[model samples]
Structure formats: structure tokens, C-alpha cells
Target: MRLKRNPTARYPETGEKRTVSDEKKRGGAFALAQRLGRSLMLPIATLPAAGLAMWHTARLSRRRTTGALMISVALTAFLTGITEPLEYAFAYEAFPLYAVHAILTGTSLALVNALGIKDGFAFSAGGIDYLINLGKSAELSGGYLAGPVLLAGIGLAYGVVYYLLFRFLIVLLGFKTPGRDEDESDLDTFEFAAAAAVAADRSKQKVVHSHRRA
Candidate 1:
């Protein structure tokens, strides 16, 4: 009684029934995004997050609040390889950036491979995993540490690239990233109101204490 043009599947977002064929037909950037799946981003462990944070600072020199928050996130990623926070920040909202990120990730993998760099196996690719893979008994400097060092070196370069590209694209196209959106402004206004209320309360308490003293 029923037929399918393509394999019937639930949409990744809404759980509605659809076909890959139908998605492909829609075409353009969204299709490409769906094809891309998730970013295979590396050093989300450090550089990428740091790049994003630096971009925020680059725009507003005195505003270091976003920078500090991102640095804390970078530390989490660097130590444990928890990258979701940074990845989700722009992935859904900006397809072009996401595409660039995926390409950069692929390039990093290829470079490491072309250099005959041995990808280490462990719980993750973070600093903790890097150190753990080096073996707890190993010395500070040795042949065993070579691969990780190279990987980290490459990561540093990638981070610089990320910072430049992200800064340029975000500014040029006005793509919202972190502290660049209205949502942040709204939140800032709410915080100001809350702080003002607290200050007024404190002032009232001081006045009451003075009257009591009188």
C-alpha cells in the first residue's frame, strides 16, 4: 500500500519521518551540513577555544570576561578532551564556519599522518592523555615524547590559523559567535538589573542601620 523513494528515517532534529533523498533534494548549505555530520575538531583541547576567546578580546580590548570563561573551557578541553562546549558554540548557527572547521580537522589529521606521526591511543587526545600515553615512568625529554610534541606544535599553528580565520569571517559576515549576539546583550541587561536591585537593597539596609544608631 505504501512505497518509499528513499530509506525512511527520522529526522535528526524533530524526529519526523523523512528520506535522505528528500534532504538531498533540498540541497545547498543545509544539505552539506547534514552530510558533514559533526566536526572532527582536534585540540578543541586548547587552540580552537583559545582562538575563539582571543577573537572576543580582539574586538573589545577591555572586555576580558568572555576571554576568561573561554580560557577555563580551554583548560577543561586540554586536560580532558571535552570539546562539545566549543563545538556547539557555532556549529549549528554558522554552517560556513562549521565547514571550515571540518576541513581544518581533516587537514590536521592528514598532516599528522603524512609526517608519519603515530596517533596515540588512550582515553582521549588531551594533555592528560598525552602525558599518560608517554608513560608515567618516562623522563621529561625523550624519543617517546616526540610524537606528542609534534602534534602539540601543529596544534599551536592550527590555533593561530583558527584565530585569524574566525576573527575575519565573524567580523566580515557578522556571524554571531559567543559574545557577538543579542542574547548576550539581553543577559547582560538582566545581570545589570539584578546587580542594581542588590545595590539598592544594601543601601536601604545601611540607611536603616544609621537610623537605628540615631
Candidate 2:
């Protein structure tokens, strides 16, 4: 996300709240720190999902369970680092739910910090490798206390809030959740498609021109 500089919020003599240059520097530093955190979380959190998947699919001998669980877990971990998915998930929801997500996300971060299972992954807890790393570290961290708490808290937070918000949104706002149907915005999809088409056309034309010149 682009950080906006509000001159009104800045020190007047400095002629910037956060000057473009200063903001760029800060952004760079934040990005680097985020990457480091993701690197650390990578090996700390993988085993639970693996074990659960194995148990659930034990009779089937299907690796799909493990693979799917791994991918889902990884994505969730990555979202903790990069929050656009989380942000977008609730962007259309009512204020209370959005507040809950924001508070919960921040609290989750704090809890993770408090557990001493800090993620130094390049990405947030929003990806597969990070979760795998998290699982590994969790294994070494004396898993009984911290492990159960993390798993339960995460599941409860996600399940309760998601179900309640989804119910409220669909029943009240008439918005669609995963299983439901409702009016959807075509503008974003159309614009993206149009942009891609334009880009492709331009690229093809450039290639044609280059060939003709050659």
C-alpha cells in the first residue's frame, strides 16, 4: 500500500508530515523487517496441520488432505504479514465486525509475540512455508501450553467471527458468503480484464513493429 504524506499532519518547518523520501525510507525498513519476520515464522508452525491432515486421511492414504491443509495453512499465515486479504474480507462488512477483525488481528499478533514464537519470515504468517516453519518451531517450543492455546484461539476467533459476520451480512445486507448467491460487482473484474487485454494488444503491436523494423 502506498503511504500518503499529509502535509497538514507534519512539522511545518520540515515542509512534510513524512516527506516522500522519508516515507520511502520508512517503507523500505518496514518491508525488510516484515520479510525477516516471515523467514522466522517459516519453520515454527507446520506440524499440527500435518498431523491433523494425516489423522483425517489416515484410512484413505491420500496426500491431498495434507497438501490442501498445507496450502490453506500457509495462506492464512501469509495474511498475517500482508493484510489486504483480511482487510478486503471485511471491507464490506458492518462496523462492529470490521472492528473485531482489526482488534483480533492486532491481538493475535500480540499473542503470537507473547508466546515467544516470533516470525522472522520474509512474508507475514500469510503463506505455507511460514506456517511450516511455525509448526517446526512450535514443536521445539514445548507445544502443550502454547500450541493448544494458539490453535484454539485461532480457530475460535476465525470461526465465531466469520460465521456471525457472514450470517449478519447475508441476512441483513443481502451479500453473498461462500455458499450463498447475491449481486456481485462486475466493475472490478471487467476493468482488470480490459486492462489485461489492452496490455496484451500493446505488447503484440510492439512485437509486430519490432519485427517489421528488423
Candidate 3:
């Protein structure tokens, strides 16, 4: 589900109206101070999508640093259950990380199912969806806190494991995950531009030579 972005996502994160080079000002500082996890990391284990989103986006979006796309995407997956953007961050290069993600996601789903934790989503299986479905799940299971608490516990543990494991693999193995890898397309563009300039220069030189001969 595409998160309808606030005209200005604020600090309590950033208030570039929408995003920015100016992120570190205040909003950026807050999320950074906590490192986003210092709890946001909890969601990916349950949602098994993001927290890593913020981590990866932070790295890749250094150009934007605290830009809107980075901030919005990370939050969207946690709140709305949209993860394609986040997944794309490392999906192409880090197939191994993706495989790990699949295992963790499957485990989350299977465990929830086995425990009979009923939940549903209107847009996706995000926090809002979880909340909306909370009542239904609780009634069926005869407890309120049980579902949230258990889910939180599992999600946090999984989140930590993923964070540490992913960090290790990315750092140690040097997976060309997004920000870490230069886009071949960018290199191609540069090469093409250079060739075009060279051709143009040669064409001009030929015309000048012909004029001198005349």
C-alpha cells in the first residue's frame, strides 16, 4: 500500500515539508540518535520487511541523506506493509540476504498461524492492519495482550538477529547491496556522454580542416 505522505513528515522526524540535505537539522537527528532501532528494528521481524529499509536507505541515500523518499519508504513498510521499495534496495545484488529474509518471513507467518493468531489486512499486514485485526484475533484467542506481546517479542528477537547477521554478511562478504555498488547504468551513461563529446569535437575539427584547405 502506498503511504500517502504527510506534506511534511515531522521529527517526533524531519520537516523538509516532504524531505533533504537539511535532514540532520532536527528530525534527522532524532531518528539517528535512537538509530531508529534504539525499536523500529522490531517491525521487520514481524513485518520482515523494513528497519533494514531505514538502514539500507540511510546508506544508499547519502546523497539525499534525510530525503523524503528514504524517510517515507522506511516508515511506509512498518506502518502500511509496503515493502517493494525496501526490498529493491538489496534485492538484485544480495540474493543471499533475500534468501535469509524469506526464511525469517516464513517463520513469522508459520509461527503466527500455528499459534492461531488471527490477523488480517485491508491494505497490508502492517501495524494498522494488525491493530484493526487485533480485536478479532483477541476474541478468538480469549486475550488481548497475548497476541501483541508475543508478536512483539518474536519480532524483536528476529529483528536483532537479522540486523546483526545482515550487517556481518554485508560487511564481511562485501555484497554489492545498493549504495555499496555503483550502478552499471550510471557508468554506461558517463561513457556514452564522453564518446558523444569526443565525436562532436572530431566533427568540429574536420570542418575547420576543410575550411583551411579551401
RMSD of each: 17.4, 13.8, 19.9
Across 1-214, the per-residue lDDT of candidate 3 in tens digits comes to: 8977543345322222112123233444222221211122234343243335334533443424323433455565677555555565556667887787788766666665555443333333457655655554444444665555566566777767777777777777777643454553445334433543454355446634543442
Query: What is the C-alpha lDDT profile of model 2 across 1-214, one tens digit per residue?
Result: 9977643333332322122123233333322322234223222232222223222332233334333433443344344332232233234533554565556556555655555542223222334434544543344334634543454455445445444544454456543221122232344324433543454355446634543442
State TM-scores per candidate. Answer: 0.57, 0.38, 0.56
How do the residues 1-214 of candidate 1 rate in per-residue lDDT, one tens digit apiece? 6755323233443222122223243423223222221111265433554446434733363246556545655665666555555565567656687888888878877675555444332333466656654431122123444455665677777777887777778777787665565556646534533543454355446634543442
Task: Give the worst 10-residue stretch by lDDT in candidate 3.
Answer: 30-39
Best by TM-score: 1
TM-score of 2: 0.38
In candidate 1 the C-alpha lDDT for residue 174 amounts to 80
The positional error of residue 176 in candidate 3, measured at the CA in angstroms, is 2.0
Please report, as a residue range, the 10-residue window in candidate 1 with the lowest summed lDDT. Answer: 32-41
Quality of model 2 by C-alpha lDDT? 0.38
Displacement of the residue 133 alpha carbon in candidate 2, Å: 1.5
Q: Assess each prediction's global lDDT (C-alpha) against the native.
A: 0.51, 0.38, 0.49
Q: Which runs in model 2 stand beyond 4 Å of their true positions? A: 1-82, 92-96, 113-117, 144-157, 173-214
